[model samples]
Each structure stands twice: as C-alpha cells, then as structure tokens.
Target chain A: MLGGGFAEAVTPLNLLLCLTGVILGTVVGVLPGLGTAMAIALLVPVTFQLDPTGAFIMFAGVYFGGQFGGATTAILLNTPGQSSSMATAFEGFLMAKNRRAPQALATAVLGSFLASIVAVTLVVFFSPLMVNLAVGFGPPEYFALTVLAFLATSAVVTGDMLRGLSSLGIGLAVAMVGIDEQSGAVRFTLGSTQLLDGISVVVVTVGLLAIGEVLHVASRSRRAPATETVASGRPWLSRRDLSRSWRPWLRGTALGIPFGVIPAGGAEIPTFLSYGTEKSLSRRRGGGDEFDRGAIEGVAGPEAANNATTATSLVPLLGLGLPTSATAAIMLGAFQQYGMRPGPLLFTQESDLVWALLASLFIGSAMLLVLNLPFAPIWAKLLRIPRNYLYAGIVVFATLGVYTTRSAVFDVLLLYVIGALGFLLRRYGFPIAPVLIGVILGPLAETSLRRAMAMSQGDVGVLVDSPFAVALYSVLVLAVVVSLVLRARNRRRAA
Target chain B: MSASVHRTTPAGESPALGDGARSFWTGRSELFVGVLVIALGGFLLIRSAMMDVPSSVSFLGPRFFPVVVGTLLAVLGVALSVRTLLPRSAATADEAGGGDGSAVSSAESDSAEAGARSDWKPLLLTGATLAAHLALLQTAGWVIAGALLFWGVSCALGSGHKLRDLGISFVVSAAVQLAFSAGLGLPLPSGVLVGVF
Candidate 1:
C-alpha cells in the first residue's frame, strides 16, 4: 500500500492535482461561506475518474489548504472561513485595524504551519496505536463508542445541550428513515419510490452544508466597510509577537489533538478552550491590556489549535473508521466507496493507502504553508468578486456534478429541492452540521446499537457494563451539566 | 461609510434582552421549540407503534429503540414547555438578560440577528441566473452558461462597466473551458456553442 501509494501521489498528473486542489481549497477557505467541505463536495464529481488515492491526495490537499487559507480572511476581513478560526478573527482583525495586518497574517500562517506539521507527525506515530485499540473492538464496543460519540457531540457542539440534544434527536430520527437491516422493514420512506434506498449521504451533506450556507450568506449584509487602513508594515512578526506567541502555540497544540479524537465537536471545542485558556493565562503573564485587542498570542494560539485539530482529526477517522466532523464524515463515505473500512484493520489491510495518505498530508501541509502565507492578498481579492456570478456558477457546476454522478435528471430535481430546504434552514439559524453528521453516521449508529442489544439479549444494563462505556457516559453527562451550569451562572451573573 | 460616526460609536453594542423576562425558556423560544418537539414526539410515537417488535429477541426489537428515544424526546419536550410556561423569579430574568449583553437584544429581530432576513436582491438575481444556466445549459452550452454565471456574480458585486464585464465574462468562460474540459478531462456541457469548438 505504501509504495504504490507514494508512487501514485507523486505522479506528475497527481502532483498538479494536489497543487491545484490546495490552491483552490485555500481560495475557497478565505471566503466565509465556502468551506473545505463545500470545496471537496463540489470537486467530487470532477475527480471521479482519477485513481481513488490520487483523488484523496488532492482532497487532503484541499482540506488543509482551506485551513491555511482561512487565516488570511480572518485577519483581513474579520470573517473566519471556518469556526476554528473564529478566535483568529477576534485578534487578527484587531491587528488589521491597527495597521499590523502583515504581522498578524504572518503570525497566523507561521503558527498554523508549525502546528500542522506537529499534528501530521503525531498522526503518523499515534495512528497505529489507535488502530490496535480499534482492532479489539466488538459490536458492543462499537455500539458504546457510537453512544459516546453522540453524547460528546451533544455536549460540545452547541452552547446549550438541550438545543443540541434536540438537534441530535432530530438527526437520529432522520437516520431511522431507511430499511432496517435485521427485520428488513422500511422505516421512514413514506412510500415514495425514491425513498426506498433512504436519503443519499451526498444529498444530505450537500444540502445541509453548501446550499444551507449559501442561504445563510444571503441573509447577511455585505461586510461593514473598513473604517481605517493602517499602513502595511513589514510582513515579519515583531519580536514581541514572536516571544508572546510561542508558548501559546505550544499550549494550543497540546489542547488540540485530544479533542480531535473525542467525538464531541472536534476542533470547535479546543479552539474555544484554547482561546479561553490563553485569555486567562495572558492576564497572569502580566500582559495586561493587549490580549483581547488582537494580541499576537490570540492569533497564534487559536490558529495553531485550529490547524492541529484539523490534522489530528484524521487519526480517529483513519484508525477507528470513525468520523469526528462533517468533512471527515464525507471522507469516510469516500473510503467506503473505495471498498475500504478505515478502522484498526485498515493499516493491516491497506497499508499502502494509509501510509500514502499520511505522507500526502505532510506534503499537503508544506504546500499549504507556501501557498497561503505569501498569497493571501490574492484570496482577499477573490472576495471582491460579484456574488451574482459566483452563486450562478455554483448552481451550474452543482447541477452538472449531480447529473454526472448518476446521469439522471431526477437527481437534479432532488438537488434543487434540497437546495431550497438548505436555504430555509440557513435563514432560520438552525445549525446544519448536525444534520449532515446525522445523515452520515445515523445509520451506522443505529445498526451498531441494535446489533449490540441483540447480542446482549436486550439487557438494559449492557450499555453501562464496560468501564470504558461508563467512563464515556460520565464524561458526556459532565459535559452537559457543565455547559448548563456555565450558562446558568453566566445568565445569573449577567442579571 | 461615515468615518466620524463610525469612530465615535463602539463596534459592538450590547444586545437588549429585557430584564423582566424571567424564564430560562423565553415565551417565544419556548412556544416555537415546544410545538416542534411535540410534533416530533407525536410522529415518533405513532411510528414506533406501527413498528413490529421481534418476539424472538425478547427485549430487543425494531420498536424498542424507537419507542424509548421517541418517548424521551416527547417527555423532555413537554417538561421544557412546562418549565418555560411557569412564571419565574425576576432576578433570574434580569440575570439571563444581563449575561451576554451582546447576545441579548430588545428588538424582535434580535432573536435571529446572526441569521436573519436581509435584502434579497442578490439572492433573487443569483437564483434566476442559476435557474437560467441550468435550464439552458444543454441549449446554450458551457460557453454561454459558464460565462453568464461568472459575469452575473461580478455584476452582483457592483462592477458596472459593460466592456470590463464582457471581457471578464469571456475570459472566465474560456478559462473554465481550458481548465475543466481540456486539463481535467471533464466535459463541459455542449449546446449551440459546442459547434464552435
């Protein structure tokens, strides 16, 4: 798997693909609504005929490319391409307004590149161990794992567990729409001939993420005009920015990897947690007033955390065959399409694919740094393009992609309907990620849980039987409780 | 656009959730979520009832999981509604509103401020252009459809010079033809324009 993988990835055609994909991904990433998920989704059909590994290499490039590219938008426009970069926006934008845009941009790029390299290194070493652990998992263990994933996601995805749980419940309901494997009974098809196979993952993912996001963008006004244009300074970080940022970068990286593996919400939690930690620590460091006003540490730490979490997320996806985010979930679908399962046995069964993917990530990370750090202005200009043409182009490409997927016009109709629903949800402020997560993992979770219960003879106690299961559930409960208590306290304090 | 006015005012103003709103579940949020929850719950309950439980499996069956999750959802939904409906202490309302001042707003629009209504001119125009592109792709082909999309968005962003727009429109579509069709080997739609190639 390794030799062939490397050879395939390094092929002239494939290298160009990786370069192009990373560049495109970064460009899209710099734009607020065009995320890595959308980029990958839009390109899926275009790359359908390429060798799967080559396709994946390009996809990987695009994923990190988006991360690298997001820093620019955060700094220049006060808008973050991904939620991971939200903290970056807080500080980077401040620096921009203060005319230190170049330095902020530099620090963000450096921090991201450094953190991503470290994350890739960790993924290379730690993935095998994860695979070993996953190899021992049974149906019961998998079931427990799914429950843990669901609970963690609920606790961390949103500020309110109740609302999050409500979302999760909706997702589960959506998941239950297909035919039951054991009983062979159709559950929620509602008798439509098209519904017999259940909702397509692509349809759901595209609907919830892309189309929804477009509508969300449509609901917002143009970004407020820049009140000031601080003179562009040297691109190099100042001595102070360098000194203040290193520790935060280290701290952010430390915080990122663990969350990457946890099922809750991947980078979102860590990014915020890292931000909060850096904020408190900055005060203790006697760095009095600058922290919230675009401290270099603020930009560095979260950007580092963001990239690290993104890279390490692959660990769980590749090792345990579990997806921790929307993008990973889609990648998981790609894996299944290639007739490969990404768990512990993946390394043993598909060593070439795994290693090549790992090596490609390293290569991709390097390419991302080179492309994003120096070329940020180009991406910023991309935002200046007209929206009318952009959305129109997307619609055209989207329909064509759908048509190519099955050469069916009916899919085109479905795409429009889904797009409309997506638009509505976005307008309503309903978080759409959960819906995609729901559609992707819903079937797997239900199937595994059902199988586990059957094996246990319907024992209610089986769920909490294992120590791991108990521990996982305890963490879940704690997360929910903590979120509630924090909210309550915050509310009370506000009063 | 007014620099003096912008400089004088703060970038972010506090959200104005009134202090008298006592419940954790506000009247409006409660009403909306309550109805949704109950409907979802009712749906699950009916669906679960229709499902057959396997006797051979004893406790485990298709109906068992659905029933449990559905009932929990319904019960929680009702509980939330009840808790929200009951009058709460003034202090709590004051507290909830005061915390996250930036998050709370006095305006009814504040509830959906982050994701609310906006001018739909661009949206409608883009939609119309997309509809046309998709509808006419086979007839007009990639050259015209693709050019229209690129130019449409450029126009939406406020570029008004006709010569500049047309030049860009042609350049953009030509590039798409070269990149997607020639380089990537993906075929652009062929219509009347296909004969030119």
Candidate 2:
C-alpha cells in the first residue's frame, strides 16, 4: 500500500499540485492574517476543479509548507504569521537581532524536516491501527467523539468558554438550515430554493476568512507596521549549532505528537511546552541562561514541536474524521465536497486518495526544507508588498472564489452577510474555530445522536453504555477540569 | 488620507464604538453576547415548536435536537447575563487571566480581548462595495464588477492611488475571467459586453 501510494504521489500531476500547494501555502503563511486554516478555506473552492486525489495532495502540501513559512517570518521579522510560531518568535527574533539569523534559520529548517520525518513515520505505522479501532465504532461512539470534539473545541480554542459555545451555537444554527435527511423536512431554509441545499461550507469559510479579514483590516486602518529584514543571506548552521539542536528536535517532536490526537484545537500548547522543556534542560546543563541569549535549542525545540503537531493532527482528521484545527476542519470540508465521508470507511474506500496524500506529505516536507532554507529571507520580503494591493487582491479572490462555488449572485450576497458576521465575531473576541467545527461537525453530530437514540428506542443509557464512549466522556471531563485548574493557576500568578 | 487628523484622533475612532466605550465593552461584552444568544435561542425554540412532526414512534424527531440546543443556549445566555452583575465579571481585571487563554488560539484571543476599536467608515464602505458587486454582477460583466470590487476595496483600505487601483483591478479581473473560462472550465458572467470576449 505504501509503495503504491508513493508511485501515485510521484506522478507529474500530483507533484505539480503538491508544489503549487506548498508554494501557495508558504506565500500565505508569510503574509500576515492569512493563516493556514484560512488559506485552505479560501483554496477549497478553487481546487474544486481538480480531482480528489490531487486536491488532497495539494492541501497536505499547504499544511506542511505553512509551518516553514510561518517560522521564517517569526525569526526574521519578529512577527509570527500563524499563532503556532509565536514561541519561535520569542527566541528566534532575538537570535536574528543578535546577528545570528543564519544559525537560527538553519536550526528551524532542520528541526522541522527531522520532526516531519519522525511524525509522518509514526503516523504511517500507527494510522492503520487507529482506523481498525474506529471501524468498530457504533453510532453512539461516533456521537460521543463528535461531542468531545465540539466541547473541546469550544472550551479550549477561545479565552472564554461561553463565547466559544456561543460561536458553536451560531454554527449549529447555520447547519440546522436546509433539508432534514431523516424525515426530508427542511428546518431553517425559510422557504427559499437556495436555502434548501443549506449554506455551503465553502461560502461561509471564504466569507469568514477572506472577506471578513478584508473588513477587519479595513477597520484597523493602522496596518501592522513593517520591520526591517536582511535581503540576501542563506541560512547556514555550524557543527556547534547542530550538536546543540539534535536532542531538542527529538524531544519537541515527542511533545507535539500527542497534541495532534487530542481535540485541543491547535499546536500552540505543545510548542510552549517544548520551549519550556528546552529552557529547563539548558538550565540543567549549566548553560547560563541560554534561553535569554538566543540558544539553538530554543529555536530547534519549538519549531520541531510546531511541525510535528501539524503532521500528527491529520491522524484524527483522516482516521477518525475528527478535525482538531481550523485547517483540518476545512480539509474535512474538502473531503465532503468530493462526497467522500471521512472516517474508518474512508481509509478502505478512498484508500488510494488517503495514502497518496500521506505520501505527498513526506515529499512536500522535504521540498519545504529545500525551498525555505536558502529562501528564508526572500519569503520575508513578501511582507514588503503594499498592504493596499495585498488586501485588494484578497478582496478580488474572495468575490471570485465565492461566486464560482455555485455561480449564484445570491451566494456572493450571502458571502457578505457571513463576512459581516465574521468581522463581528473577530471584533468581539469570539473564537472562529468553533463556528467552523459547529458548521462541519454539527450535522454528523445530530445524525449520530438521533441514530443512537432511535436504535436504543429512547433509552438514554445506550448513549453511554459502551466503554469506549465512557472513556471519551471521561476525557472530556478531564479536559474541562484541566482547563479550570489552569485558569485558576494563571489568575493566581497574575494577581 | 488625512494623516494629521488620524494622528490627532486615535485610529479606531469613528461615529461608532469609542475607546472608552470599547474598554467598557471589552471583557464585559458578555452582556451583549448574552442578549444576542438569548434572542437566537428564543427564535430557535419558536421554530422548533412550529415545525411539523413526521412521526411519534421515534423518541427523537427533527425538532428534538434544535429544542435541546435552544434550551442549552438559552440557559448559557442566562448564566452569562447573570454573571455580568457580579464583581468577577469586570473584564477590566481580566487582563491577567486573559493571557491564559486556550492553547488553540490564545495569541489571537489576546488581541480581541484588548477591545481594539473599529474604524466604522472604512468598514461600512467595504460592506457597501460588496453590496454594489452583488447588485452589479448581473448587469455589469464580471470584469467590470470584479474590477470595481478590487478598486473599491483598495480605496476603502485607504489606498491613495486611484488610477493605479483601477488599472490593477481591471487587470486582475480580466486575468481571473480568462483563467476561469479557459483553464478551469467554469465560465463567469459576461453581462453587458457579452461579445467582447
């Protein structure tokens, strides 16, 4: 299966798509406000023209390539393109300012490549096991997992759990539109033909991520001030830097893999943890505050953690059909767009597409190393593009992308309505991921719960009757408790 | 474009939410959220109640999940609303605690929690531009409408180069039309100048 996947992935068409995806992903990642998830969200509609296998391969490339691009900006400009690279900025910018930018860039690149290899290898070996386990799941188990995903995303993705839940509720309400499959009764369409099909995830995402972003930037006329960066320097690492970085790279990958599986919303947690671990280890080694003065371990460890979590996060998305991050959620939307329901069945049914995607991930990460290592400084120059043109171009793509989704003028109008909502949500501190999750998983969640209810003939106990479901519920409770405890701790520390 | 005026007056100031108002609304905006959610919940409950039931044998029906979700939202809305009355709801004090946001996107949450005000004029202009695009899509070809969208949005974003914006917008729109029609095989609307292409 692995060999077959490699053969399929190396085809010229797949290779070209992968290259395009990674390059596009890197460009967006380097641009402020266009994070990986939003990039994928906007791209989903454009890739509608491509075959399923090629689209998935490209999406995978974007996912991997985004990590390198984000890290480059963080090191050189002290601005993290995506939030996952914030920890990298903590130490990376210092190294760059201290005139060791070359060494910092090198460690980040090598660490990401090594971590991607380690994480992807583990995924290749372990994914089939996850699929096997998921294959045994019933409606109850599936319902329980979706509930876990919903609750975890709502509670863990935002600062305020209530706000997150509110966003989730709005998404659910939106999802409630269109025909009810079980009874063929339309719920929230309000008697419109277009409403019968329900709101397109593509429409909502483009409006929210792109149009909403344009509005947000428009509202904040004070553009993010550009900082200085070097023009022509290839990232290079000395023997000393390599010796210092290898162990941290391994440790960071170890730290990040578990986060990929849990519905923890993103990789920021593991990156911070990896950074802390490196700081302590440096202290333990009597390195005299290496963390303060741009240590190689500081850059290596968190970069590894960020990339590792990105790769491993796909496991749940592919094996279990649960998306833990916004990017993964949109990718799930892409899968559904092709009428391929993700989960255990997808592994067996769309095995060719899934395996080819995994194979391309390996190829893409290797390409990321080659493309980003020497071109780190050049990618940072993307920031120098006129903000007016950057935003203007995004607006053009936003309207075009949405219009082409169904070629309906009404959809473009709907895009603005959702765009306003997106702008409002961002303005008010509401977590956007839950809305996407609620939009994507809301239907499956409803269907599974009703199926479980129907099967048990109204006995609610059947919902929690299974040990696997009970285990998932327990994890949910544990997550809530952990969050509460952490909140209290942080409050006390702040006081 | 008036740098002096913008510099003297803060960036986010418009005829909308002020900095003082924003600070008050920042963390404490739970009241606003609570009220909006309660309204939504009420609407959902009413809709679920009015829907026709296809069967009585099944314990769960089409309305069942919506009713449950509605009730949950309503209860959450009430909780948030009531919590606002307490001393703890002072998001003013939330500065320290806000830093401890979720692992997923705490970095971004920090900015939103900062209660940064919006420049409503530009925001409104951007909205109007989209509305115009929608209105003009049928009458105006995509090239004209799409270019207008690009130019309008750039102007709203405070671009000073009007002629340049127009030129760039037209180039972008025509290029997109060509790509979509020939390459992607999805034809866009060629409204007024139908035979030009």
Candidate 3:
C-alpha cells in the first residue's frame, strides 16, 4: 500500500505541486500574522481546478512547509508564525542571538524531518486500525464523537473556557443558518433567497482567518519592533550537539504522537510538554546542560514534537473524519468541498487517493528538509518585505479569492462581516479553532442526533445504548472531571 | 467614548479612578459581548418559533435544535455577564496568579496595547475603502476597484510613499486582473472596461 502510494506521489507533476506548496507555505509561515490556516483558505480557490489527489498532495506539502517555515521565523526573529512554534521560539531565538543561528536552524530542520518520518510511518500503520474502529460506529456513536470534539476543543483550546464556549456557540449559530435538511425548513436565512443554500465554509474560513487577521493587524497602532537579521553559516551540527539532541528528539516524538490522535487542540501542548521534559531531564543530569541558556535540547525536542503532532494529526482527520486543529478543520472543509467525506469509508472507496496523500506527506517532508537547510537564510529575507505592502497584498488576494468562489459579491460582503466577527473574537481572546470546528461539525452532529433519534423511534435512551457511544460519553465526562480537578488544584497552588 | 471615560470617574482619587476605570472597561467588554449574545439567542428563539415547518416533517421538527441552541446561548450569556459583573478583586486574584494566569495577562496586555493607542482613523478609512471598492466593483471595473483598495489600505497603514504606492497599487491590481481574468479564465467584472478588455 505504502509502496504504490509513494510511487504515485513521486510522479513529476505531483512533485512539482509539492514544491509549489512547500515554497508557498514557507513564505506564508515566515510572515508574522500569516498562518497555515489563512494560506490554505486562500489556496482553496486555486485548488478547485485540480483533482482531489493532486490538491491534497499539494496541501500536504503546504502543511509540512508551513510548520518548518514557522520554526525558521521563530528562530530568526523571535516571532512565531504559528502558535505551535511558540515553544521553539524560546530557545531558538536565544540560540540565534548567541550566534549559533545555523546550528539552531539545523537542529530544527533535522528534528522536524526525523519526527515527520516517524509520525507519517505511524499514521500509515495505525490509521487502518482507527478506520476499522470507525467502521462500526452508528449514528449515536458519531454524535457522541462530535460531542466529545465540541467539548474537548471548547474546554481546552483556549485559556478561558467561557470565551471558547462563546466562540463555539457563535459558530454553531452560523452553521444553523441554512435550510434544515431533514425537515426542509428554512431556519436562519431571514427569508433571503441567496442564503437558501447556506453560508459556504470557504467564505467563513477565509473571512475569519484571513480577512479578520488583516483587519485586526491593521487596527493596531503600534508597529512591531524591527527584526535584526541573524547571520547564517553552513547548517552543520557538531558530534556532541547531535548526541545531546537525539534522545530529546525521540522523547518529544513519543510525547507528540498521542496528542495528534486525541481531539485535543493542536501540537501546542505536546511541544510545551517536550520543552518542559527536556528542561527537567537536563536539570537531572546536573552538568553543563545549559537549559536556560539556549539548550540545543530545548530547540530539538519541541521542534520534533511540533512536527510529529502535525503529521499524526491527519490520523483522526483521515480515519474518523474528526478535525482537532484549525488547520485540520479547514482541511476537513476542503475534503468536503471535493465531494468526498474523509472517514472510514474513505479508505475503501478512495484508497488510492488516501494512500497517495499519505505518501505525499513523506515526500513533502523530505522536500522540506532539502529546501529548508540550504535556504533558511534566503527565507529569512522574506521578513524584510514591507509590512504595508504585504498586508495590502493580502487584502487584494483575500478579495480575489472570495470573489472567485461562486463569483458572487454577496460572499465578498459576507467575508468582511465574518472578518469583523473574527477581529472581535481575537480582540476578546476567544479561541478561533473551536469556532471553525463547531461550524464544520455542527451539521454533522445535528444529522447524527436526528438520525439516532429516528432510528430509536424518538427514544432518547438509545443515544447511550451502544457501547461505543457509552464509552465516548464516559470519556467526555472524565475529561470534564479531570479538568475541574486540575483547575481546583492549580487554584490552590496559586493561592 | 472619551466623554464616557470622563463621566465614569469621580473626583478625589483621579489616578486611582483612572486605573479603576480602565480596568473596569477592559474587564467589562465581555459584558457587552454577553448582552449581544443574549440578543442573538432571543432573536434565534423568536425566529425558530416563527419558522413554519411542514406538517409532513418528522415529529422533532427543525425548531428543536435551534430551541436547544438558543437556550444554551441565553444561559451561557447570563453566566458570562454574571462572571464579568462579580467583584473584581476575587476574579482578578483567581485569574492573575493561576497556572494559566500568564496566558490571560499576556493576552490582556496585548489587547491593552492595541486598545490604548488605537487609531480608529486608519481602521475606518480601510473600512470605507472596502465599501468603496464594493460599490465601484461592478461599475468601475476590477482594475479600478482593486487599485483603490490597494492604495487606500496602504494609506491607512501609514505608508508615506503616496505616488509610489498609487503606482504600485495600479500595477498590482492590473497584474491580478490580467492573471485572474485573462490568464486563468476566471471572469472578473469588466465594468467600465467591458469593451476594451
């Protein structure tokens, strides 16, 4: 399976798409305030013309490239392009300031490469089991899973649970706007004919992530401090540095794999966990560990952990049709846009496409390593692009992208409206991930719930009749209990 | 807004009053959000009630989920508002020193920084520019509308190179229109240039 997939992915046309995606991803990732989510949102229109397999292959490249590119900016400028790379920015920036910039870049690139390989290999082997489990799910089980997703993301994605919940609620409200499928009753359209078909996820995603981000950044009065360019040399690691980094890389990979499998947010937690673990492990050594002073392990561990989680995050997306992060949520929307739902049936129905996409991840990771090592400095120069021009360009592209989809001006207007909401969400400290997830999952949850109810002849008890549904609900309850207990303990400690 | 700021403060402890007022406003923005959410919930409930589901549909009907969602929103809205209006000292203590406290404070400071010196001039200008582009898009053509948007955004962002920006905006918009409309075969509104291009 893997061999055939690799052969498909390595085709000349697919490889070129991969290159384009990685290059584009790196540029987006290097820019502060531009992210993988926004980049992918903007790319949806461009990919509409391509076959599903080719498009996904490009997306896989973009995802890997985005992560690697974010690490570059985090190291060079102390500005993380994505939240997952925040941990990397800690020691990475320190290393850059200490004139070990090349070594830090090398560690990040190599660590990410190594972890991607491990995580993708894990996905290839383990996704089948996940698909097998999912194949047995009934409507009740799926509804339970959706509930778990909603609860997990809203509860843990943001620091403030209320804000997260509010975001989720807003997303659900947005999701409810179209005509109800079962009853054929128009729900929230306000009698508008244009809205009879419902708000497109593409419009919502682009509006919230891209346009909203632009508006928020524009509203800021203060300019970011000018970044000092760090000098780069050949990206070669010394023997001792290599020896110190290997163990942490493995440890971080171990920590990150589970996080991707769970419906918990993104790689942020695992990366931080990896960093903390490396810090403690170094302290236990009680030697010249340099934990505070730009420890190589600090950079190595979190970089690997971040990449590992990113790779494995595809598991739930591919096998269970569950999205755990904002990017994954957008990817889910992308999958749906192609008229293919990514779940257990996907393996049997479109096994070639799925395998080829998985294979592209491996190919894209290898391309990223090759592209990033020698071109790290060149990519850093992207930072020098004028802020005004860059943002203005984004505005133009965003408008163009929104307009191209369905060629409707109403969508363009809706884009700005949603963008404004996005601005408020950001300003008010609401996590955007849960909102996107809610919008994507809301309809599915409703459908499953209704289907389950109909199946049981309106017997609510049937929702918990299945063992899988019971287990899922049990886990949801346990998650809430554990979080409450942990919060109480933290409050006690703080007091 | 500044008048509200002035009226909210009392006489004696002007400095303390200012700090308190700032925190009060910053801390209570969520109050407005909560109220807005409640309004949305009320609207949803009213709309769902007004929805005329066919008698042939399932017993559950379309209103069931919306009703549930609206109720949840209303409840959550009340909870959020109550949380905001509670005694600040306790809330601050709980939020400030906890494990996630750093995250909260950092985010607060970030918003504070953006809020403190927020120049609405640029924001409003950008909004106006977009509005103008929307109005002109069909009549003036993609080239003109896109150019205006680009130029207006650059100005709003405080770019000093006016002539250069205008020139570049034109080129950029023209290139985009050409690429998208001509190269990619995606039909952009020709507007005034309908015959020429």
Native contacts, share recovered per candidate: 0.22, 0.44, 0.28
Comparing 1 with 2 on lDDT, the higher-scoring candidate is: 2
Model 2 Cα lDDT, one tens digit per residue, A372-467? 888888889889888878988888887788888788998988889998888777765667788889999999999999999999888999999999
The global C-alpha lDDT for each of the candidates, from Candidate 1 onward, is: 0.66, 0.81, 0.81
Error of 1 at A45 (Å): 3.4
Query: Which pairs of residues clash in candidate 3, taking residues 3 or more apart in a chain or in different chains?
Result: none
- Alpha-carbon error at A136 in model 2, in Å? 1.0
Model 3 lDDT on a 0 to 1 scale: 0.81
**Chain A TM-score, prediction 1:** 0.91
Q: How far is candidate 2 from the true structure (C-alpha RMSD, Å)?
A: 3.7
Expressed as tens digits, the lDDT of each residue in B1-197 for candidate 3 is 11121233323122335665865554355577789778878888999999989888665678887888888788878877787677765554444322221121012213223322235678778888888988888889999999999999888888879899999999999999889887888889988988877
Over A1-495, each residue of candidate 3 has an lDDT whose tens digit, in order, gives: 988898898999999999999999999888876778777888987788788989999999889888888889888888778777888888888888889889999999999999999999999999999999999898889999899999888875455677667778888888999888888889889889889888889988988887777777777775777476575678899999899889988998999988887877878788899999999888889844586688889999999998899889899999999997778889999998898888999999999999999999989999999999999989988888778788889889989988987888888889888988887776545677777888899999988999988888899998999898998899889988887777778778867
What's the DockQ of model 1? 0.19
Q: What is the lDDT of residue A8 in candidate 1?
A: 58
